[model samples]
Target: MALFHVRMDVHIPHDLDPEVRAQTVAREKAYSQELQRSGKWRELWRIVGQYSNISIFDVESADELHEILQGLPLFPYMDMQVMALTRHPSRID
Candidate 1:
C-alpha cells in the first residue's frame, strides 16, 4: 500500500442552511469513521485556529485515495491537497 498526506480546509458558507449543515457534518463524521475502521485512514489531526485537518492515509494508489476523498460528504465544501508519501531512506520499520 502507498501512503498519502492530505490537507483539507473546510469552507462552510455562512448562509448555508443550519439543518443542512448539521446533516452534512454528521455524514462527514460517519464517513470518516468508516474509513478509519477500514484501515484506509491512518491518522487525522485538526489544525489549531482553523477549520482544517491534516491526515495520513494508506491506500493502494492515488486513484484509490481520490475515490475515498471524493466520497466525503463535505468534499464540495473542502479545499484539499494531496501528496504521495514515501518512507525516508534512513528509517527502518
Candidate 2:
C-alpha cells in the first residue's frame, strides 16, 4: 500500500433546521472507523469554519479516498473538493 494525503473542502447546511448536521456527523464518524478497519485510513481531521469545514487525511490511494469521501449516509447533504496531497520537508530531527 502507498501513502497519499487527501484534503477536502466540505460545505453543509448552515441553518440546521432539522439537524442535517447531526446526522451527517454521526455517519461520518462511523465511516471513519470503517475506513480504518479496511486498512485504508491513515489519518483525518476537520478544521473549524463559518459555513464550510476543511478536512485533511491520509489514505491508500486516490480511488480509495474517493469512495471513502463519498460520505455514504450523508453524501446528498454536502459538497466537497478532494485532492491528493504531498507533505513538505521537516525542519530538523
Candidate 3:
C-alpha cells in the first residue's frame, strides 16, 4: 500500500496550561483510538517537528485520506497538508 504524509497545522483553541495541555494529550490518544475503530488510520510515526506533527497516512488513496482526515476530531480546528509518498529506504525502524 502507498503512504501519504500528513502534516497538521495546529493552533490550539484554548490556553496552553498544564491542565488544558493534559486534556489535549488525552484527546490525542483518544483520537487515535477513534481513528483505529474506522480501520483506516494505521499506526505510524507522529513526529515532533519544529512547526507541526507529521503523521504518515496509509489509506487507499489521496481522496480516501481526505475522508479520513475529515473524520478526525482535530481536523475541524486545524489545517492539513497531505502528500503521497513512495517507500523510503530509511525511517520506520
In candidate 1, which residue pairs clash? Answer: none
C-alpha-based local distance difference test score of model 3: 0.69
Give one digit per residue, the lDDT tens place, for model 3 in 1-93.
668777787666665576866676587668767766766566545556544667766677777787777766556557887778886798686
TM-score of 1: 0.97
Deviation of model 1 at 66, angstroms: 0.7
- Enumerate residue pairs that collide in model 3: none
The better candidate by TM-score, 1 or 3, is 1
lDDT for each residue of candidate 2 in 1-93, tens digit (9 for 90 to 100)? 446554444455677656767877787779878777766775656666544444545566677666766755656665666656654597464
TM-score of each predicted structure versus truth: 0.97, 0.55, 0.60
User: Which candidate comes out best when scored by lDDT?
Assistant: 1
Model 2 residue pairs with clashes:
none
For model 1, the run of ten residues with the poorest summed lDDT: 84-93
Candidate 2 residue spans exceeding 4 A from truth: 48-61, 72-93
lDDT of 1: 0.96
- For candidate 3, report its TM-score: 0.60
For model 3, give the 10-residue run with minimal summed lDDT.
Answer: 43-52
User: What is the lDDT of every predicted structure here?
Assistant: 0.96, 0.62, 0.69
Ten consecutive residues with minimal summed lDDT in candidate 2? 49-58
